[model samples]
Target: MLTPRWILLNRRKLGPITAVAGIVVLVIFLGSAFFSGPSQSQLDKQKSFTTALDNTFASRSFRFEVESKLLGENGFYSKVEGERVMPDKVHIKGTVLKTPVEFTQVNENTYMKDPFSGKWLTLKDIKLSQSELFITELNPLANFNFKDIPEIEMVGEEDLDEDKCYVYELKPNVVNAFLEEQFSDFYYKVWVDQKDVNIRQAIIKANRPESGNSGLDMKIRIWDYDRDLQIDAPVKASTTTQENVPY
Candidate 1:
């Protein structure tokens, strides 16, 4: 539903993510796992579980909704919704620190609309690529990289938007630099498609004693897997792609 004009009018100046990127040394934010036994059934279960995660992460195209909160807070702190088209294109919009943020990316270029001047600016120099730092920053799923995975078990099954899904619970440890110093206890509840092995929904909760009593948590819902889509750059005349960068 977010069109070119809608994004330009709605997005605010970058805040927390921008701060993280500005520091340079501490960016690349974002995070899973399991145990063993003496039985063949256990091994099969583990293999199936790992396979679901692998296939889901391999989802090159999908629409996603990521709602995250700082632990010990009263309500969700960040509510972002977006779509990603494979290779190198993304569109995301939501609020951070209670301020709206929106952007579109195609390859090395990141486009944003200045809240003050209401003008589009293209950051062609930024490398928010899959192989580098900003992958986790833009794609919340990239944060699922786990340094250690705790015991995982099939928790239940459910219907998400009419899609039959298998649900699993995992208490994982991750290295999300964005949350490293401030958050702890990465607990996840994931829903995967019954037939496609693709992830459908996930919720991540972490503790942050400083925020309040609720701590921090994030919920992600993914859909429209691999659907054909077109994500294009803004107009040449209206966007500032070649001028000196102005934030």
Candidate 2:
């Protein structure tokens, strides 16, 4: 019923339309490849950031601010600021129950400043490793290894302290051993500087039986990297040893 001429005409008519449809399909395939989900490269980026963070803190000093909000019947909160130097040295100052308190550790010696006496009390024979002072596994910036984490996901890009950062969501692989029982669950979103891979901020949500509300929320900010700190013993006149203080 159909002639050869008619067949040729139909094929010619379908050529452009078929080509357009093929192009549309190709575009979709490429789009999905580019934007579907976390690719291998994305995972590598997050790992790279974590590695860089570990390396950076190993040889550098930084300042940190910790803010905590207690949820429960008591509604308690606190903000603590501290600076740490590598090898050994940390200075932390905070207020508890409207009372100001501070402590400084240098090498094997630690000194606690009494709020009421206005004097520094020496706490002897204390050695704090970098891991303990920096909160290695508990903090986003200090944990160099993530072998425990089942997976980490890129949350997206955002701004922190006016700087652009790539945000990543992570959960700690916590194991119940000794004090670990107190730490129930941990969720963290870390913001790393897009330019230098430096950590700008970390939001940590934790569950602990120690809290009246059993919820612990903390935000840690790191800055002032590589800055020299002047940490010297308090004036002798203003300082007293625990044994020297009158009971």
TM-score of 2: 0.71
State every prediction's TM-score relative to the real structure: 0.71, 0.71
Report the C-alpha lDDT of model 2 over 149-181, residue by residue, as the tens digit: 665787789988788888888886654342255
- Candidate 2: list runs displaced more than 4 Å: 4-37, 74-76, 127-147, 174-179, 209-213, 237-247
Over 4 Å off, model 1? 1-46, 73-76, 128-137, 209-214, 237-247
lDDT of 2 at 42: 87
Error of 2 at 176 (Å): 9.2
* Window of ten residues with lowest summed lDDT in model 1: 27-36
Task: State residue 152's C-alpha deviation in candidate 2, in Å.
Answer: 1.0
The number of the candidate with the highest lDDT is 1
For candidate 2, list the clashing residue pairs, or say none.
none
Error of 1 at 70 (Å): 1.1
- Model 2, residue 57: C-alpha shift (Å): 3.1
